[model samples]
Target: MRRPRSPSFQVTPKGERLDSHFISSLSRPFYLLLAITTASLVAGVWRWQASPSMHGAIAFVMIWATLDLLFLLAALGVLYEKPQRRSEPRAWLDEELVLWVEGRPFRARASDGSRLGIGVDIGFSELDAATRQRALDLFHKAAIVTLRFADGKVLQARIENRQWGPRQQHLHLGLAYRFANIQDERYAVDLAFGDSARLQENLDRRHQGKSILGALAHIAVLAVIEGSKNLWWQLRNLWDLAYGAMGRTLRHGKTKELT
Candidate 1:
């Protein structure tokens, strides 16, 4: 006789899940940009004293940098900020499915209930041979189903439909219909969820793979600014506190004599 599966191997029901790492990943770029801007401002200030002619350009950079810093800090705070907990009871589509009407997190299930008689009934009679085979192919692969209601609410659920027997034929059929109606006006499927880490990894790869030309352009601009500072300051004296004070005293003495 086949042995029953251990409790450790058994699938456990999961409650609503939140991706705190995703939230942190979203905010990281802003902090990085802020740090770069701060470094540029410090370098600009040091160059400003020697090259007073670039004061106008430095002031412009400072103003824009300060404004951007404030905006980024505010956005970072808001992104990291947690939403207020809602005490309202959750709406359930079924025992396994929870309706995510609000922006709050909702439970997701691994099983598709269409095979369990809870969803729309679909059979071979409903679909042509080619379509039925295609649907079967889809079932063999892990798929994410996203459903949108008439009221603009959306729900995403992950399922492996291939495990279901003939009794659950409608589950994949319903998924097939939903997939077909994706572009239709009446059926609004917004997004789907699969491997969370894979998605985040793709985003990170795209973010890190900055265009070579774009990077070169940025380097070129910085080079121009630094070059201009170096060229302009070559003809100018370094700002000396004693020299400035002496000049101010001489100007005062000249004014007194004239008076």
Candidate 2:
């Protein structure tokens, strides 16, 4: 008689899933933006001292404050832009053992009876050619799914990596939920690949919309900053001219009085 295999040896969602490291990658830029704001404020104040005029002081304060505010707001945008937690190759499995033991995690379903995260670990090795194509089609349906944690906080998760290369054989992904119950069960998805080829042109084409929007946003921000550079320089130059003329006049007046 054939022996029953241990469930852990098989590719199953029940195994300990790896942790996602995307958040760590994002922290550096987030903190750098904050540091830039602080530095700009200090430098702006130092430069403001050179003016010594009432209007210059006001302008310095205003511009300095504005830049600092812009930096801060931009930093906040970066800081708030938390990467959605999910399982990837190095993904995290929420292990609040107590929560699972206590049954405290909340899970709901869509209008259809499909459980929020209830998934079956179907392997590529098991499927025939026709079924394999169908599986790949469903992988193409992968999307960035958003979920709310037990605390009601929301998070985003990418079902498929947009940058996945054509040469890749199988699909790897992470599922993340914000404020997940530490005790909730961890899941895994395994796709066995018999043949690896670039799936289709349409899969790659589907992401162009997001890419275009991101590009447009970057261009808009760049245009604003580039347009303002000359204006800032002109105001700065006018301040210096006024201050220099005043100092020269005072020196001349003092010399005449002494003579």
Candidate 3:
């Protein structure tokens, strides 16, 4: 007689994939660069228009507006592109143990003599006091967990407890702590609630006692740059509108489209 193969579940990456904090942290730098580039381009165009042989200020303004419109369209295209989907097959989950996987809820009980184990302790009691506390803290705050089993299979799951409350928290905490302390390369626990790089950067900032102050400065700078950009665009639009009206008036019932 042949042995039966264990049933496998599919693992999919889903829900809130982007780290907002990471994006927020970079906003200041992004706006600063944009402001510098826009200013440089405007200065260059103004200098060119100042030359006696070049087109008038109106034409220069129109040229800059055209460039701005093109840039906006390109940005929209990139922003609205379809998001890529990634998934892993043959990822097994013990439904009884996992409250939810990747934000989707499901329930299942382990079958008799099944090899599938969920949240089973590898060795939590053996860890030292400080390491144990760190693991506990990690689990308590964890929204996502990556688990590796003894057989070298990897499982990534999102934790959600709707009914069990503190019991559920304790269960997951024990499992996560145990897995985190595992020494073997084959079995591991990885928790992700925020971007790792951002977290490290924040830690570094805190060590230097500049985290809060730096964040406030970034927001202030971003606000000023963005406000200036918006005001410039509004003025440009008004000028273009007036220019169009003037051209139509001069042409006597004929109008030209500005590209």
Best by lDDT: 1
Give all candidates' CA lDDT scores. Answer: 0.46, 0.42, 0.42
- The sequence of per-residue lDDT tens digits that candidate 1 reaches over residues 116-215 is 1112222344667786676556545645555444445444444422334454444422233233333542322221223355447546755786587777
Ten contiguous residues minimizing lDDT sum, candidate 3: 108-117
Worst 10 residues of 2 by lDDT: 95-104
Model 3 C-alpha lDDT per residue in residues 1-259, reported as the tens digit of each score: 2435866666874542332212123234434555565676676677776865655664666566545543443333333323221121112222233233344322223111111123332223445778556645555565765544334445554443212224232232212222222442233212221235644754575566547768656555554554445445545767999999988787854544341
List the candidate 2 regions with Cα displacement exceeding 4 Å.
1-36, 46-51, 57-65, 68-73, 76-259
Instruction: Kindly indicate the candidate among 1 and 3 with the higher TM-score.
Output: 1
Candidate 2 or 1, higher TM-score:
1
Residue-wise lDDT of candidate 2 within 23-142, one digit each (tens)? 223435534664575577667666667555665665756676665555444433443323432332231122111111022222332110011232212234445778556655655674
**Top candidate by TM-score:** 1
TM values, all candidates: 0.26, 0.21, 0.20
Error of 1 at 147 (Å): 42
Question: Which residue pairs collide in model 3, if any?
Answer: none
- Candidate 3's clash total is 0
